[model samples]
Target: MDDSLIIYVVASMVTVMAISCWRRRCQKSLAPVPSGYGKVFKSHLFGKPTIVSTDPEVSKFILQSVSEDFVPFFPGSLTELVGKSSILVINGSLQRRVHGLIGSFFKSPILKAHITADMQRDLQEIMASWRDDQIVYIQEEAKYMVFQIMVKTLIGLGPGEHLQFLRHQYQKFVAGIISIPVKIPGTRFYRSLQAKKRMMKLVKYIIQEKKKNNTGCISRDIIDAFLNDGSGQLTDDLILDNVIDLMIPAEDSVPVLITLAIKYLSDCPLVLQKLKEENTKLKHKSLEGEDLQWMDYMSLSFTQNVISETLRMGNIIPAVMRKAIKDVEVKDHFIPEGWCVLPYFRSVHLDKEIYDDAYKFNPWRWKDKDTAASSFTPFGGGQRLCPGIDLSRLIASIFLHHLVTGFTWVAEEDHMVNFPTVRMQRNMPIKVKRKNIDILLS
Candidate 1:
C-alpha cells in the first residue's frame, strides 16, 4: 500500500477509537442533557430518554440519604459548560455554610418587599402589550420576564438595560450547561460559552466596583449577602454563580404555574370565579417587607390552597436525578454503588395512594394547611428542599392574587393545552382583559 493509504487508515482508526470511548463513557456513566436539548432519549441504547429509576424509595436513597456516596452533582459535560462558579455544583461542608448565609438574605421583609414591587412591576411591564388585545407568546414571554425577576430580586435593581442584556446572555449561559461540547461555528456550546464569559466579565467588574465603593449593601440581595457576610463564609466565585443560577425561573415558576392553574380553573369555571371572589376582599396596597416577615398574613386559606394546588400539579421537574455514592437498598432493589436513579416526581404528585381523584385539580386539597404539605413539594423535599420555598410561595401567591383578582386571562390558543411535550408545554397563550380590570384595594 502507498504511504497516503497508510496515513488515511491510521487517521480513520484514531477517529473510530475516540468515538468508541465517548460512547462508552456516556453509556457506563450518564453525561448530561445536551445543550439546546431538542428531545431527551430515555434509554442509553434505545429510542427515548428512559426514566432510569422507576421506584420512589430508590430515588429517595440517592437524592436524600446517599449523599455521602455520590459525587454530589458534577457531570463532566455540565461542569465544563457551567464551570465551577455555580452553587448547584458546590458540595461538602462548605456548601452547607453558603446555604446558611444565603438563607439569611431570604428574610420575611425582603421577600415581601420583592413580591409587592419587583415581581408585580415586571409582570405588568411584560403584559402591558396585552391591553391592546395583542397576541403574545407567553412561553417566550414567561422565559424573559422571569429572567428579569430573577436578576433584579437576586442581584439588585441597578441598571435595567444592562441587567436584561446581561440576563439574555446569562440565560444563554445557563442553557449552555446542558449543551453538547461542540465548539465549532454556530454551535450551542460556543454561543453558551461566549454568553457565560460575557456574564462573568460583567459580574466580576460589578463586584470589584461595589467593593471599591464600600456599598456595605451586601445584604441587599442573596448574592451580596452570601459574598460579604457571615464570617466571610462563602467564596466570591460561588457568590457570582449563585447570583446567576438562583435568578433563573424568577417568572417562569409563577407564570407557568399560574398558567397551569388557569387550565385547571378553565375545566372548572366555578373555581375560577370563586377565587376571584375571595381575592375581592384583599387590598391591593401591596405586601411590604414587614408584612412578609410574618408569613401567616398572606397565608390566606383560599390563596395558599390555589398556590399549593398549582405546585402539586406543576411539579415542573419530572424527577430529581441522583446517583448512589455507596451500596444502597430500596424496595428490594440494591441500587449498587454506581448506578444512577431518577425519582419521578410526577408519579408522587399524582400517586393514587396519596391523593384523592389523583388526576383531578383540587385547590381545596390544600385548604386544610398541614394536609396539603404532604401532597405537594413542587420545589422539592428534605435537606435540599428549596431554601427559597417560602419566597417562591409568596411570589406565586402575590402574582395569582393580582391575576385572578384583577383582569381576565383567557387562552388564546386551542381548547386543551399540551403537556409532557416540553418545558411548560401545558401553558396556553393567554391574553389579558385589561379594560375589565378590578381595582381591589379601593
Candidate 2:
C-alpha cells in the first residue's frame, strides 16, 4: 500500500473514534434514568458533568439547611453579564447586607403604595389602548406593561426617550444570558456585553442624579432609597447589580407569568369563569370607583388560585443551579465539592404523587391543597427565596382583576414551548373584546 493511502486511512480511523466517543458522552448526558434510581442523579448538561436532584427533601435541605454549602452557579456568560456583586450570585455578609437593604424597601409601606399606584395607572393605560376585537400579542403587551411598571416603581423612570433606550438595551442584554460565552464581535455574547455596558452607564447616571437631588428625607423609589442609605453599605456597583438583577426577573419572568395566566385562562374556560365571577364582584363592591386598592387585591382568593395554578403549570423558572462548596451527601447520593447541583423545580411541580391529574390545568386543586407547602416552590424557598413574591403576586392579581373584569380574550396560539424560557411559540396572540360596561359595574 502507498504511504499516502496508509496515512489517510489512519486519519479516518482517528476521526471515527473521536466522533463515537462524543456521541456516547452526549447520550449519557441525556439518558432517562430508571424509576428506582434514588432522588439524586448524576448527569451531564451542555457537555459539563453535574449532579441533579429531583427530591424535594434534598432541594429544601440545599436551599435552607445547607445553603452555605452551595452558592448560585451562573454560567460564565451570565456572571460576566450581570456582574460579580449581583445578589443572585453572592453569599455571606454581603448577600445579607444587600438583601436587608433591598428587602426592607420592597416590604415597606411606601414601596407597596408606589406599586399599587403605578401598577393601576400603567395597567389602566395598557388596557385602554386595546380596542374591541383588536389582536394583541399577550406576551409582548404584558412585557411592555410590566417593564414599564418595574422601571417606574424601582427607579422612578417614566415614559421618555431614556426609558425607551434602556428598554432596548435591556432586551439585548437579557437575550444573551443563556447564550454561548464567546466574546467575538457580532456574537450574542458580544452584543449582550455591549448592551450591559450601556445599561450600567445609564444606571450610573441615574444614581448620580439621585444623589445630587437628595433631600435629607427618605424616598419611595429603590434608587432614591439606595442613594439615601446612611449605612454606606451600598456602593454604586452593588446598587447597579441588585437593580439589574431585580429588573431582569421583573422584565422576563413576571411578564411570562402574566402571559401564561392569560393563556391558561383562555384555554380553560371554567377557570376563567370562576376568576371573572370573583373579580367582577370585587369590581362592583369597590366604593372608591375606577381604581383597585391593595386590600382589594389581597382579598382575591379564586383569582389568586388561578395565578398559583398558572405558575405551577408555566414553570417559568424551571430549575435553579447551585455549586457545592463542600462535599455533601443526601440520601444515598454523594455530591463532591466543586460539583454543580441543580434542583429541578419543574419535576416537583409536576410530580404525580403531589398533584392529582398533574398534567391537566386544574386550578380547583389549589382550593383544597395547601398552596404554600414546600412541594410548590415556584418562587423557590428558604433564605434565597425571591423577595419579590408578594409584589409578583400583587401584579398578577391586579392584571387578572382588570382582565377578567373589563375584557374577554380568545387565545390565537395553540401551543406554548418551554426550553430556555416559558413562552408561546407565536407570542400568544389574543383577540380581546370589551365586556359590557354595565356588567363590569354590576
Candidate 3:
C-alpha cells in the first residue's frame, strides 16, 4: 500500500470515530434524569440549554449569593447590538452606578408622578378605540397601549395628531432593536438602523428646539430629568441610548405582563369582581399625582395575589443567561470557565417541591397573610435581578387597578388562551366586557 493512501485511510477512520462519539453523546443527553422532580435533564436539540440545576439552594447561590462570578449571557445578536456599556451588558461597580441611575428614575413617587396621567390617558384612548364588547387581539392592543405609555411619559407627546405620528416611528425604531449583524437590504438590522436614525433625528430636534427657545418646559419626569440637564452628563447621545435601553423593553414588558394578567384574571370572576369594586372606588378620586396612591389600600389582598400569580404562571424572562466567570461545580457536573449559565426561572417557579400545585393557576398563593414575601418572584431574584421591578410593579398596579375596576373579561370562543411554558408567553385572547359605572358600586 502506498504511504499517502495509508494516511488518507487513517484520517477517514479518525473522522468516523469522532462522529460516532458525538452521536453517542447526543443520545445520552436525551435520556431522562432521576424521576418525579423537576425536569432538570439535558437535551442537545435546543443546544442543551435546560437547567440541570432546579434546586433552590443552587438557585440562591447563582441568583443571589455569587453574582460576582457571573455576567449576563446576552443573545449573541443582542451583544453585537447593545454593545457593552449600556446597563444590560456591563458588570461590577459600573453596573451598580448605571443601575442606580435607572433605579433613581424608577423610584415610586417619581414614576407615579411621571406616568399616572399618561397611563390613565393611554388606557382611555385604548378603551375608546375598542368597539363595545369586542374580542380584539389583546396582545396586539396591549402592545400598542404600552407603546403609547412609553412615549407619553418618556417624551412629552401630549394628546394630538403629532403624538400619533411620533409613536409610529418610535414603534418602528423599537422593532429594529432585535436586528443585528448583516445590515443588508430586507434585513432586520438595516431596517433597525434606519429606524434608530429617524427616532434620534425626531427626538433630538424636539430637544434642540426646546433648548433653543428655553421654553421653560421641564418634562417633570425622566425625559424631564434627561432634558433639564440637556447635553450635560445626560448628553443627547446618552439620552438617546437610554431611550433605547428604557423604552424598547418598557414597551414590550407592559403588554406581556398585561396579557398574562388578563389571561389569568379573566378566569376568576370573584377576583375580577373584587378588582372592579376596588376600581369603582377610584372614580371618586382624582386620577392625577398623589390621588393615584389611593390604590395602596384598595383590595390589597386580591391585587397582590393577582399580580403574584400572573408572574408565577407566566414566563417573561424564562431562563436568565450569565457567562460563568470561573469554573463551577454542582454535584459531579463541572462547568468550566467561559461556559454560559442559565438560571431557568420557569423550572424553579413551577418546581413541584417548591410550589405545591405547580400546575394550578392560583393567586392566593402569594397573599402575605403574615409578613415575609414568600417564594414568589416574577421580577427575578438576587443581586442582578431586574432593576425595573418597582416601576414594573407600579405599571402593573396602574393597569390592573383600572382593569379590575373598569371592565370585566371572558374567554373568546375558539380563540381561547392556552399556556405552554416553553417560551415566555401563552398566546391567549379574552373578551373584555366593559362595565357600567352604576352596577360596580353595589
**Can you write out model 2's per-residue Cα lDDT over 190-305, one digit (the tens) per residue?**
89899989988988898888888889487757888777777877789988987877888777888889889998888889888888888878878653465567767977888888
On lDDT, the stronger of 1 and 3 is 3
Which candidate, 1 or 2, has the higher lDDT?
2
The whole-model C-alpha lDDT of candidate 1 against the native structure comes to: 0.58
CA RMSD, predictions in order: 9.0, 7.0, 8.9
Clashes of each: 14, 0, 2
lDDT of 3 at 281: 64
Which stretches of model 3 miss by more than 4 angstroms? 1-52, 65-68, 128-131, 159-166, 173-180, 206-219, 223-236, 277-291, 294-299, 329-333, 368-375, 414-433
- Candidate 1, residues 217-325: lDDT per residue as tens digits? 5466565665567576556777677776676556345556655666566567777777877666553324322232234436567767776776677666555555556
Clash-forming residue pairs, model 2 = none
TM-score of each: 0.77, 0.89, 0.76
The CA lDDT of each predicted structure is 0.58, 0.79, 0.59
What is the descending lDDT order?
2, 3, 1
Best by TM-score: 2
Better of 1 and 3 by TM-score: 1
lDDT (0-100) at residue 208 of candidate 2?
87
